[model samples]
Target chain A: MTMNKLQKSERFSVVKKILIIITSLFAGFATGVFGGGGGMIIVPILTGLYGLQQTKAHATAIATIFPLCLVSVIFYLTHGGWEWKSGLVVTAGVVVGGIVGALAMKKIPAKWLQPIFYILMIVGGIKMLAQ
Target chain B: MQYLWYIIAGLIGGVIGGMGMGGGTLLIPILTIFLGVEQVEAQLTNLISFLPMAIVAVIIHAKNKRIDFKAMLWVSVPALVTACVGAYFAPRVKSEWLSKGFGAFLTLLGVAMIIKIIVQKIKSKRRANK
Candidate 1:
């Protein structure tokens, strides 16, 4: 039974694999272009297409974005448009806050956070557009 | 004084980003709109700052066994190759357009997320009633 199940799972068609790759490439392009869309793109594809669990999708998206972000950084740096000093300062805060936030996720359920995040995004977006 | 703002922006963006949503969505706006940084500069800064935050978050999530390593392989390579493609075009785009585009993108993302949650809630409710 286990072997049969494994075989069944392994039988993803070439079309399916190609679709996944295409979706992933689009997600990466969005991430590179927006500098922030990786999770927004990857999580949905993982959950909707691959049927991964929500938490697992979120975690996996982060793992995937890590290398993609690194690659994007190389191009951004070579292009000479960034301020290293400001970037470093922000990074210091981001690193510390990231660890704290990750730990905090264990304490709070994601459902509770989603509404607030959406509201924040809307407000931030409106503020940007208004300016 | 300005450094303080940068740190604060980073910290907030980091926390949110570490939560599994991209920080650049929030960080870039905070830097560009609020802190008065240029669009390209803010974007670059966001990308740069994002690296460390993502790395740190991944570490924490991995420790908790939240990550599905197998699924990661499918996205990583394709994403890695295309990310540079996007970055290459970023600077060439006009700043005004970039700002407007980012704003529109964020608004759409917010709307989509809200709709998704509402749909999920209704579906779960129907399931429970059934």
Candidate 2:
């Protein structure tokens, strides 16, 4: 889609706002308790529940992460569990990776991406268990 | 049916995030594979949702004095700037390649984490043996 088309769709209706808010809250809570996974719920909620198109939903998701990361970083810092040097390094990596990943998102096809994503999840889950 | 999945996703995500792992590692895949969300949508959604939670967590951590503001400044400044750049460019990339790339990255990271844990455990054991 062209930039104009994407821009036009960016504006949210009342219902969309409500849905986004509700979804964002749920996502927030999940992130707090799980350490990550808000986006898993956010995307589906946006697409399935809120009716946003795929790319737009993704863009919106990135917009939302800023607040969440800020909150978590603060909490970690205050709690004394965070390693500043490590967090800085990781965050730096995430930023760079995130940009690259985002740019890549616009070029990749959904079909190939979805299955591979699923496989990674299953493997990750199993790995978590092993850990 | 869908709501059920959302609930499940929320629960799983919460647990994972609470533990300090990346929920995106799991969430993106579930959305794309089972829920039929596109890769871009799923990833963005994960990033977006992370915003509030990270903020809250940071607040709590900050109050408890866990935050490293000096370090955070370095990390967050770049993170914020890059995130915007990422968001702006994401949609132009094709979906499949992004998915594959993300998936591969996650897999490698997971494996590396596991390996690190094992190595740590062995090193500890050897230390104890001595």
Candidate 3:
């Protein structure tokens, strides 16, 4: 990339930054409120508005959600809503599944992934709402 | 066969989690709605399960240079703070209301995405014509 183009791309607009932070905050809030789904929101903002590549956006969204998840977990533990045994079992699945999924990211094209994500979100949202 | 479900659930959730889409969204519903786990327990399980997956995915992404650490830092601070606040306020809301609202939000996003696709197609078609 040319220096001018690189600089232009890297330059963070104040408006954009604020928008990102605000969205991030809301995503975090959603995670806390729903105890999940923050990444759903974060990934979109990163990919759509922040202009991150799809793969990077997916990875970054996970990274961004880490701290928020930790915070909420603390509350879940203290506030008396956890089932450790079941959580342990699920954790085992996620650990293995997560690694595989991350590797799988390389195989999928961005065009396909975005729609898959949207479909998952729509399906998940509907299921939760119906329940 | 009974414990198989947990492993299967974890594996699926882990894969999705690694994809950065939040496995809990998938895992929780599967556990609660299908597997007969209680809602709160399912939610908590999702949270715990994501921890290790997140760590693994992030580390891999980091090595691949896929993560923008600067943006991660910028988003994390407020997210961390608000997450706590959201958790604090969560108990006040009725579970039914919460589910309904979350459901509505997801549907809205889905609709928005379809609109986005249409808009982009129109813009490209215009460009092509010129």
Candidate 1 residue pairs in backbone clash? none
Of candidate 1 chain A, the 10-residue stretch with the lowest lDDT total is A7-16
Q: Write the per-residue lDDT of candidate 1 for residues A30-90, one digit (tens) a residue.
A: 7787777677878888898777998888878878888877877777777775677888999
Compare the candidates by DockQ and give the number of the best one.
1
All candidates' TM-scores?
0.87, 0.51, 0.80
Docking tier of model 1: it is medium
Model 2 DockQ class: incorrect
lDDT for model 1, please.
Answer: 0.81
For TM-score, the strongest prediction is 1
Better of 1 and 2 by lDDT: 1
Cα RMSDs, all models: 3.5, 20.4, 4.5
**Cα lDDT listed for each candidate:** 0.81, 0.50, 0.76
Error of 2 at A97 (Å): 26
Q: List each candidate's DockQ score.
A: 0.69, 0.05, 0.62
The top-ranked prediction according to lDDT is 1
Cα lDDT tens digits, model 2, B1-130, are 5555654554444344433344557765665666676655555445444554555554555565544343223223333443333444344456765566555555654565455446767999999999
